[model samples]
Target: MIFSRITEVLTHVGVITLLILLAVTLVYYPEFRLVVFLTFIMVITLTVYISRRAARKPPKLFDVIADEVRRGSILFEVDDDEVSRLLEKDFTLYEEFRKQSYKALLESVIIVPIFLWYFIYFYLILPRFVITDLNLRLIAYIIGFVVPYILYLASELVFRVKTLTYVLRGYEVYDRGIVSSSQYIVIKFPLSKDYLVREYSNRKCVELSRKHGRYTVRFLLYTKNTPKLTETLSNYGKAEVISS
Candidate 1:
């Protein structure tokens, strides 16, 4: 865990350093800005493309659940039979959710905007601004402000959609508790804790209280066996069904 945190910190530092260098180059060496800009765009585009492609291919279900169990520090014993049963029931559904989530993230939030910014700035705005026409320069400035604002809104909308989809469909029940995944984020709520299980309409949700506060979370997919699941959860804490 320490190594992982250190690696994350180093990665952030590297990215910030690169951004500062790129900015300095743009300011002091205008002649090379186009080359640098194109290179950066190409790198981002390729990285996003590769990442999306890789995310579409999920690992074996047993491996995924095993990794999560270890990461969550789950104390209850889980054998191969239990793991296989869980996988047998939810593997296909989990795969489908993952694909949709990652696709939404890549196209709506990452790759499309990179290409859009490249086209808008490099091909359109930059060339016009270079001519030094007052009216055209004003238009360029307006576009510079507006485009990113619009992209920000779009990105947020897509992020919310992806987040909701992930939260609703992606969770697994183990002997200890429930494990959920959202893209790279994983959260586990052990049944031994202060928790509540509630059902509304077709959805079943869990609320876990931590040092910070209570978090009410809904599962990503609906199951017909919600009553059974709720009964199992009640063994750990308060569990009930609520009217819609």
Candidate 2:
């Protein structure tokens, strides 16, 4: 229940911070602050819903990988009841995927707008302010503009290079308790994201089951996760890997 507990803590913190901000706004900018706060609340709700839905249906990349890993006939072709069993244990995995997708999508969508706003505010608005109030440092303005752009680019790169799906199971995403040496390798979904090279198109993937004593990934350099790879290796037991 760590996830539920942490979720509660974060929700509490966010709510409290929002309340404080609202109180400050009421005191400092009573004219239009309430309207802005209402807009913020609406936007936040919409974003959370859209993100949760998108997480349920990741772009083709994760779709392909999840399909392969979840529906693969080799290990996944289980009885209907057994399939349900696999889905037991946790709902946090799905939530984790949803949160990451939301963050990445938000980053992608915000980059351009953020850049444009910065250019307009600093170059047009700030200079006008400087003309009226002589305390504006030109050097500081230049640094601020450059720093934000650099940060935006870096964030974009990080998102592009990061994993589409991340999972934390039992106690941790990498938790390896006495789950019994699974006949089908119950890899907790996120068991090996740092080194997995699965694709995202909900494509079919081959599973290992001592079938000829080998396991493998059929593609190379597909999606981002921590440790990126360009190809599958001859041995997967020793090397880390996972599907979306």
TM-score of each: 0.43, 0.30
Please write out the lDDT profile of model 2 over residues 1-244, one tens digit for every residue: 3564476457545644554454445445659755845754564445444433433342222212222343422311223343344335335435755776787687657555654655575457755643332223433443433455446445644554233322211110112210112222233333243434433323222122111111121221112222322122213223443445
For model 1, residues 155-180, the per-residue Cα lDDT tens digits are: 54454332222333345555444554
C-alpha-based local distance difference test score of model 2: 0.38
TM for candidate 2 is 0.30
RMSD to the hidden true structure, all candidates: 9.1, 16.7
Misplaced by over 4 Å in model 1 are 1-17, 30-34, 46-110, 130-190, 200-229, 235-244
Q: Which 10-residue window in model 2 sums to the lowest lDDT?
A: 171-180
Q: lDDT of each model, Cα atoms only?
A: 0.46, 0.38
Worst 10 residues of 1 by lDDT: 207-216
